[model samples]
Target: MGRNRISGVIPSSLGNLQMLNDIDLSRNALVGSIPTSFANFGYLFSMDLSNNELNGSIPKEILNLPSLSTFFILYNNFLSRPLPQEVRFLEWVGTIDLSGNHLSGNISMSIGMCKSLEKLLKANNMFSGPIPDTLVEVKGLETLDLSSNELSDSIPPEIRNLNAL
Candidate 1:
């Protein structure tokens, strides 16, 4: 349904599509919460619910997907909250864009565990505190944008050492 102005709630039962490999509901007017049942899609590896009115934190099970490689939910109306801990375990995620939301929390040190992380766009949120030193472990990280936030603490000078690591 190209160019269809989809509105209203996404049917929760759509998550039952077990063999689903990808879902692209972006660039639409879909409202309401993302169905938690979608986590049951074992083959689900890519999802894009961006540019919508979806609120609340992302379902934790979405992160637990062993094959999830790209999780992009940027440009939504979701509120401030910490990223799920299990998300740090994604071994193939090369990029994560949680930008333009109300997300506020300490940047988890566990982000370092996502060794495959390359592009991380977290700008325009209420995220506070200092950057975690462990982020240096993401050797593939090429872009990190955290501008426009209440980040109060000064970035330690030692953070510059990440360039050498």
Candidate 2:
């Protein structure tokens, strides 16, 4: 459910659906961290927990979902902390949006490992440090918005080769 009056913490019991392919709980008043039990969704392809009151770092287990290929959005939440390095495991994901949060730290260099990534929106957060040069490895990246953060240094010259950008 999304864009509703729903409030309170997301139920951890929702993770028991191993056959689930998509989940949309966005635009709600939900609070609390994402349940680690969500890692059990082996078939999940897309998940939207955006526009909520959720806090805490994104669960590395969710990042490890092999079937999370279409999109994974946690936008406009209260989530914080460095994005987990395990995000490198999303090799087939097409889009990832973690914007409008309290997350901090350098964007993980390992993000280059997302071989199929297209749109990566990470603006409006506290991320600091130079933009990782490894981002050039994501050849399919088209819409990369790392604006509104504390990122410094020049954009890597190699990024010019990404024709899709």
Candidate 2 backbone collisions, by pair: none
Best by lDDT: 2
lDDT of each: 0.75, 0.94
Write candidate 1's Cα lDDT for 73-162 as tens digits. Answer: 555566457777776867677778888888888877788888887777788888889887777788777778888877777675655655
lDDT of 1 at 99: 82
Tell how far residue 5 is off in model 1, in angstroms.
1.1
What TM-score would every model get versus the actual structure? 0.87, 0.98
Range of the 10 consecutive residues with the lowest summed lDDT in candidate 2: 152-161
> Which residue pairs of candidate 1 clash?
80-102
Clashes of each: 1, 0
lDDT of 1 at 9: 81
TM-score of predicted model 2? 0.98
User: What is the total number of backbone clashes in candidate 2?
Assistant: 0
Off by over 4 Å in 2: none
